[model samples]
Target: MSESAQQIGEKSQVILHFDLKLNDGSAVDSTRVNNKPAKMVMGDGSLTPNFEKCLLGLSVGDKKAFSINANDAFGMPNPDNIYHVDRTKFASDAELKEGMIMGFAQPDGSEVPGIIRSVAGHSVTVDFNHPLAGQDVIFDVEIIDVK
Candidate 1:
């Protein structure tokens, strides 16, 4: 099949430029900014199922913009992901501020990033939810290739 005739499918390899934005029009990420497009194999778990659904049946040169809800996108924030830690757990020299992202070591030795939600007298609130959790997102995509 001709490259231009190939459509995005469950097993197709796709190359595309994409812009991710929030509902309020704030840009989250864009492949176009660096002049480099992204490549991915469909159904490989790289893109969310709902996001991939938007690309199905699209051929090269196709451009589309779609919106995904919070639950379907990054997912809704889980209240259990929030934790309160003693302020002493943080380095004495480290400045803790709301909205600051910091990496915390897990029991398995892998590091997970958490956002500082607040700092009280001797306690700190951190949230481990994905940064975009609970927010609707807009995806703008231009298909460059499908193989």
Candidate 2:
């Protein structure tokens, strides 16, 4: 099958370098150097629709680049995601610091990463939401090859 018509369970290898940036053109993530090949399964829900669409009909040694809008990338952040926690949760001996990354449990029995926001007398405010929740992100994808 052609790269664009790749089906689920198809085994393929492709090397790609990509840049993730904010709408303001701030770089967030990129796999430019140390180039590596990534294997993907179609219909696994791993790649966003927009991203998948861009990958369609590609071939090995085919170098194609494209950009994706925020909605198709990480989506916007939700305000309801911010949360608060008790300072005592961190052992008395533990030092609470701002910008600390911690894992918090969610109702779905999943761990959500949170960043420490502030430390008050007895409370530690944390933002469990993704740091880019409210912002739109840009994805720069390049297809190095496809099987």
Model 1, 22-53: lDDT tens per residue? 99999999999998999999999989899999
What TM-score should be assigned to candidate 1?
A: 0.91
lDDT of 2 by residue, 14-109 (tens): 455667687678888777655654556545676666666766666545555465555566666666766677777777897779999878777899
- Look at candidate 1 and tell me the lDDT of residue 28: 97
| Maximum-lDDT candidate | 1
Candidate 1 residue spans exceeding 4 A from truth = 3-5
Candidate 2 backbone clash number: 5
Give all candidates' CA lDDT scores. Answer: 0.95, 0.66
Top-scoring candidate (TM-score): 1
